[model samples]
Target: MFIAIVPAYNEEKRIVTVIEKLEGHVDRIVVIDDSSFDNTVSLARNAGAIVLEHTVNRGQGAALETGHAYARSVGAEFVLHFDGDDQMDPHDIAPALAYMKEKKAQALIGSRRLDEHSTVPWFKRHILLPIGKMINHFFVRERLSDVHNGFRILHKSVLDSIVIEQDKMAHATEIPAKIIAKKIAFVEFPVTFTYHEYGQGTLSGFTIIKDLLFSKFISK
Candidate 1:
């Protein structure tokens, strides 16, 4: 069985649409509400997704870990981690899953480099990208065009082998490191990058830099 695991946090604006997009593509959908203050949980439940909520906001890592555990519990053969903000396009799911089965990979990452102009913020491309590349090259010893993208598909084995401890945004940077450390069989396929309406709020340029510094140097 295939399962979609969505880690959401106060994503009342776009979570429903994301779930709708996943319909018919997977066997079941699991929404891990990270203690969203809004009606995220109720919206997801109403949308026909199994909703699980954290008592308090434990962070993205915890949310994702929770989703993964639930997916495994249900005996999912392939599990996909999709963002609640609709940054990842649902169209890439079929091909990515096909590629995973063809390659027999333990984990599959949907890379966003294929897009001519990545929807990722400019600061992320200029600053965070470099820091991520440096960390991957030095610590992980692998070259990845997109390191922190939330769009990913993986086998239960990889999820079982690795554990995410960083209960924050840094989980994006840390997940690949753990995958590399374990020498898991993983592959990446180019996928589209487009942030949706949820990203309407303007983020200062420094915010990306600050998160990168914290995740790369301090949080680790």
Candidate 2:
């Protein structure tokens, strides 16, 4: 069966729409609420998602790890890692999933390069994108255009093989590195994205660099 794991933190305004749009696209939609202070859990449950709430505010990485683990325990054959911030376009779900199935790859990462209609910011396109690509290339040995995208599909084997220790955005960096170390077969699929203002900069560039360095080399 197909499962989508959405990690949310206090996202009440748009969770309903995200869940509503994903209907018929996935078998099960699991919202992993990272100790949200708002009504994220209740809203997700009411919107027809299986809500998994964390006791404390662990970061997105922790929430995603919990969601994927629960999905595996319940016998999910295919898993889609998504965001609850509504930055990812739900329209990409169907085609990306179909391509994943066709490729039979252990993991399929979403790249904005595939979507010609994607509108990215100047700083992200000029500075952050290049930095992320270089960092991911060093670890995965593949020059991926978008490395930290949360929109991706993973087989159970790929998810189970990689160990996620980063508790924040750094998990994005850690995951591909683990996949490369495990020698898992992965492919990149183009996906469109929408940048929500509130969700775009939870952490600054310096903070992101610190997290990436610690997760990629220093701490890990």
Candidate 3:
């Protein structure tokens, strides 16, 4: 059984499209609403996703843990960690999962390097991307173009092996570190990140900068 775990916080506008896109690919779509004040839960349920609502806003890491636990409890064989902002392309799901199966890898990260059409901002490409790569190389000892990408596939075995300790944005860094520490086979597949004007930078740039620093420095 393949499961897709999408962590959403007040993302009512685009969750429907995200759910609809995963329709045939994923056996079950679990959307964890992280204490959103909006109608995210109702909209997700109406759009055919199994919804899990958190009473308080615990951040993306908490939401993902909730979904991952639920997926494991329900006997999911393979799991896809995704974002609810409609950024990830659903078409990458099958191929990415197939790569993991073929390689017998415990985890497969859908990297954005293969996307030649990405229009990422200059700062992200110039500053953040290199910083992320260096961190992955130095700490995780894995050479990958993208490190903090939220789209990835994991086998149940991998999920079982790693304990997610981070409650916020650090899970982006923590997951890979845990995978490597356990000597799990890790592979990276290129994926495209779609930027919707409505969704891009929905949070403040300063807030994103702060979280990026926290994930990179403080979380480590």
Candidate 4:
């Protein structure tokens, strides 16, 4: 089975659209509603997604972990992690899966930098992302073009191997760290993100850095 796991929080406005875009791309769509205060859960269910609820607002990482567990329990052969916000292009899903098969990689991560035409914001492309890349390299020791992108696909073996411990944005770095630690064959694929009014701002970058640094400090 193929499953797409979406971690959502108060994304009622775009949740249905995200699910709609995902339809026919994967066998099952699982939406982990991280204690959304809006109509996200009901909207997602109405859109034909298998909705999983969190009583409290766990971070995106924790929500993804919940989705991961459910995916594994259902014997999913491939699992895709997609954000609830309508940023990532669902059209990239097929090519990414094909590339994974072609490269014989157990996992594939989407990279905006790999696509020359990707319209990344100036500050993000020139400043924030570069700094984030450096920090992630320090932690994972792998030079991934895009470290914090939420779009990725993992084979069953990878799903069984890595565990997401950082229950926040730091889980971005943690995922690659564990993937590298386990020596999983992974590759990066070109993908586009359509920025909108609700996209993450500059401050979130610092938050991610703080979380990563704190998590690293405690893990030692």
Candidate 5:
């Protein structure tokens, strides 16, 4: 069945809205709480989402891996990574699922860059994102319009093959790199989004680059 895994931090206020909007869109909604200090787990369960938790704050990447693992354990064939911060539209769900089947792809990535209707801040549109695209392209050698959008769909096999080692924001960069290294069939779908300011300033391009360097080069 189709399952959506939402990784959330201290998003008690927004998690309920995200879960409710995803209702009837996917078969199951699983919220992976990254040791959130707030009542995110309780609210997610109250909102009818299957809630999972990390005893420690393992970051977004770890939360996602936990959710994916749980989705697979529950026999989920199609898995979608959704944000719990209420930044994305739940309407993109159906099209992304359909695109996965149409392209016979193992993974489907939603790109805000492809949608004319999407909008973002000037810094993201002209600065951070372009640098991200260039860095991602350097590794994959593919022209991907967007690299950091977390809206993604993956077949169980894709998840099985790709191992997420980064425990934080760098996992966003690591996932696609592993997919490219393994030659997995993935397609980028057009998806619209609204960029919010919450937690947006935590990491910068330099931080991402430093993490990427450590994970891709030094760690190895």
Candidate 6:
């Protein structure tokens, strides 16, 4: 079965809309509420998602790992990792899945840079993302068009192969790094993003790097 896993943290305003957009796109919708204080769990349950709750606020990566474990438990054939915020375009889901099937790939990551129509902010488009991309390449030893895009689809086999140990934003790098290390067959599909003011700031990039280094250090 196809499943979409959304990791949400106090996203009451947009969780319902995100769930609504995903309704018919995937067979099942799983929302991992990372100890949200708001009505996120109630709202997601009302929106027809299988809601999973964390006792405390772990980071996005930990929430995703929780969702992954549940998906695997239920024998999910394919899994899509979607953000709880309304930034991702649900319309891109079908095309991305189709592309994955067409290429016979085990995984697919969304890339805004692949589409000329994608309107990325100037600083992110030119500077922040480039630095992130380089850092990911250095760690993962793989070159990808977009290293930090959260929209991704993975076959169940791929899911079984990699483990997400980074509990925070560093999983953005760690996921790809693990995938590359396992020699997973993957591709990048063009996807659109709607950047909001609440999005991660420039300083968050440094935080991600720090988390990544710490994760690597601990792994060693």
lDDT winner between 2 and 6, please give it: 6
The TM-score between candidate 1 and the true structure equals 0.86
* TM-score ranking, high to low: 6, 4, 5, 2, 3, 1
Residue-wise C-alpha lDDT for candidate 3, range 21-110, written one tens digit per residue: 999999999999999999899999999999999999998888888988997799899889989999888988988888888998879887
Candidate 2 Cα misplacement greater than 4 A, ranges: 198-203, 215-220
Count of backbone collisions in candidate 1:
0
Residue 183 lDDT in model 4? Answer: 95
Model 4, 66-123: lDDT tens digits are 9989988999999999999999898999999999999999999889888775678887
lDDT measured at residue 188 in model 5 versus the true structure, 0 to 100: 90
For model 3, the stretches where C-alpha displacement exceeds 4 angstroms are 197-220
lDDT of 5 by residue, 1-220 (tens): 8899999999998999999999999999999999999999999999999999899998888888898788778878999899998988999989888888988999988898886767787777777778778887876567787877899999999878876777888788788877878899999998878766633442665677777777756543
Q: How close is candidate 4 to the true structure, as a TM-score?
A: 0.95
Model 3 has an lDDT value of 0.81
Q: Who is ahead in lDDT, 1 or 5?
A: 5
The TM-score between candidate 2 and the true structure equals 0.91
TM-score for each of the candidates: 0.86, 0.91, 0.88, 0.95, 0.94, 0.96
Top candidate, metric TM-score: 6
Worst 10 residues of 2 by lDDT: 198-207
Higher-lDDT candidate of 1 and 6: 6
Of 4 and 5, the candidate ahead on TM-score is 4
Model 1 C-alpha lDDT per residue in residues 1-220, reported as the tens digit of each score: 9999999999999999999999998889999999999999999999999999999988887899998889778878888989888888888899999988899888888786755545767766666667666664654568887766788888889878887766766677667878888999888888887855434122422343355456666543
Model 6 lowest lDDT segment of ten: 211-220
